[model samples]
Target: MTARPAKAVSRRPPRPARRTSAVRPPRAGRGGPRRLYSRVRRAWDRPLTAYYLILGGSLLITVLGLVMVYSASQIKALQSGLAPSYFFRKQLLAAAIGGVLLLAASRMTAKLHRAMAYPLLAVSVFLMCLVQIPGIGVAVNGNRNWLSLGGPFQMQPSEFGKLALVLWGADLLARKQERKLLTQWKHLLVPLVPVAFLLLGLIMLGGDMGTAIILTAVLFGLLWLAGAPTRLFTGVLGGAVAIGALLILTSANRMSRLACIGATDPGPGDQCWQAVHGIYALASGGFFGSGLGASMEKWGELPEPHTDFIFAITGEELGLAGTLSVLALFAALGYAGIRVAGRTEDPFVRYAAGGVTTWVMAQAMINMGAVLGLLPIAGVPLPLFSYGGSALLPTMFAIGLLIAFARDEPAARAALALATRKPVFGRKPAGVRWKTMRRRVARRPSGER
Candidate 1:
């Protein structure tokens, strides 16, 4: 009876029954993958994303290359009875000079770029021709691609030829497109393809198959962006491949390199020495690497550890992580260049960006491929990530071209203008030209308002 009375005294409302269904509304901003995807899309959609990516990626690669260069070149320099900092200092000076060129290029208008195209081409062709002369041309590692400036400094006209081809080809295509000539396949291939082959011919004369390959990539990129017909593109590609194979077969040196692809031994006369050593360097570099300046491969074990084989040295010193970081940076730069090319309304900008991207990406792939034993060692330095000043300068200038194109985008221009308007120095914040406003207000009595 007491228990019944106590139960009856309880007057609280019963709790709502729990639903058996497990489904529930998604929490706001709680969609893990979808939210991440949305955030990434927003970030990529920003107007200045490409500009920042191009600038930041190039700078990072250059800076990292400098460090790697110094580290990798020290022993080589010492063995040569030179200062350990010799290569580093030279590369640093080139980077400094290249910075000026980049700034100038990034500031130039598209019209200015077009105007300089012919002049640049002429200069590059002249220099490349000079590289063929017996006394004037300096031969390095059996490739007569270097020109001595005076004492220790040398230049590679082939590198400049790459930039020239991009600019000249872009201008040529842009003009043809403006004249409505690209619709005809002949116009698309005529001068551009012919001129590119001419440059390739010059590079091949220097025994630089690698540079020729890159130039070919730039040519194809230009044609592709110009909307070449499938048949035309394939015909051109097949012809280039045939020519390349024929050239490789004829040269004992080139054939030797081809034979070294994926080689594990040094072969007769140590023909595959560099290739096998490169693999050894990479294999020695485990996940995190042996640590910076700690690579055994750099200590006389690997040739050109700071140039063509720098990627292997990088792997040995900084490990797989460092190599991947370099790759990611290149990928970001390439993606940004494509974005610039895709987003631009200007024909010149589109073609130029695409060509430059192709040149750099193709060169990078070839260099890294050789290092990884997937390709024949082409003796081409890693763009912006190797020791050679000749490679670094032109590559940096190309990067600057991407920056200029990115900045030329309407949205990017607006964003840049807005950024410049922000207050800095001792100046007041935006919307408040405090001093000037105060002076104007003070000059006009309060009652005047």
Candidate 2:
């Protein structure tokens, strides 16, 4: 056995040593520390400064709103034998719901948003119609535009209508532009006439002139973005202004309010009373502010302080500095929105974003102007700072849309991801996956082989 083993033990020369590189295995698909590091790097690369400006501004305004609402509503609520926090609680709830909506809307794609435009517009129209129904529509301070959903949950469909109109109009204009048909008046009239009629008719029925004006502004913005004829747009603008003037003249209260702009000592219970009080609040606030919850006018000295006059209350509480801050926030929103619209190659997004920006910023200006007595009381609430569910929901959603655009911005995605600490790829369907197949050759049956 030993002899045979020795004879057979002609071991082959040792196989050449397999040389291996010293390199470490490719790090497993960015896991743990690597994944975190990559995310941090990506974030560092992408900054969402525009988004932060808008969102931070919104948060600041909302916080100030809570303080002002409580301060402004307390006296009224107490006089009416209700809790001081009544309006504050309602506003806080609305803000909470609005924040959720904003986050959700921010996550939606432009395509999905455009697809939703039709349904949303339809729903808005239906709700606006519902507000005309007796019993369901509650008259608030003589306006029959409010739908009472029972137990302090009243909504004004017209507020939502503003957003819907902007979305719908933007979609319509985008589509027409894509087809190179937007320049034709007939094509423009299709979406334009109905939206205008719907908004104007509903608002006229509800007597919500402020909202109607905002809707018109949104329409005009869309038209401008669609590259409508300058002459035609200018003509429309003139006509609209004339019509608005006529409407204001015909309305006794509106005319009186407008006349009261520079009047001193507007008598109590007069149309000018609120404006006078607002001016007083602003004057008293001066530079720094009267300090939170310390406004003199909010003690039943000012009307609708938590709504139309909330800005005045903010001024009175937080001062000129606060007012400027609020203004700055809105400016930031406008800038971000414009940037998004400009960056988007898609016409729909461009128009939609522009329309929304106009809708919101215009409304803000009107509200602030009204509060400062520079314009008549238009009954428009300060966006994100007013104490109305109707206004809060849509405003937050609009902000969300802006955030979505900002997030998707090509130049700023890295910054935005870093700021949000969220994945930039957005959400995807769960079942999506890739598969590989190995090729197999089949021989003919054994007989053929």
Q: Point out the worst 10-residue segment of candidate 1 by lDDT.
A: 437-446
Model 2 alpha-carbon miss at residue 249, Å: 2.3
- Residues 326-434, model 1: lDDT tens digits: 9999999999999999989899999999999999999999999999999998888899889988888888888889999999999999878756654469665644333
Per-candidate TM-score against the hidden true structure:
0.89, 0.81
- Alpha carbon lDDT of each predicted model: 0.91, 0.81
Q: lDDT, candidate 2, residue 193? A: 62
* Model 1, runs deviating above 4 Å: 1-31, 424-449
Evaluated with lDDT, which candidate comes out highest? 1
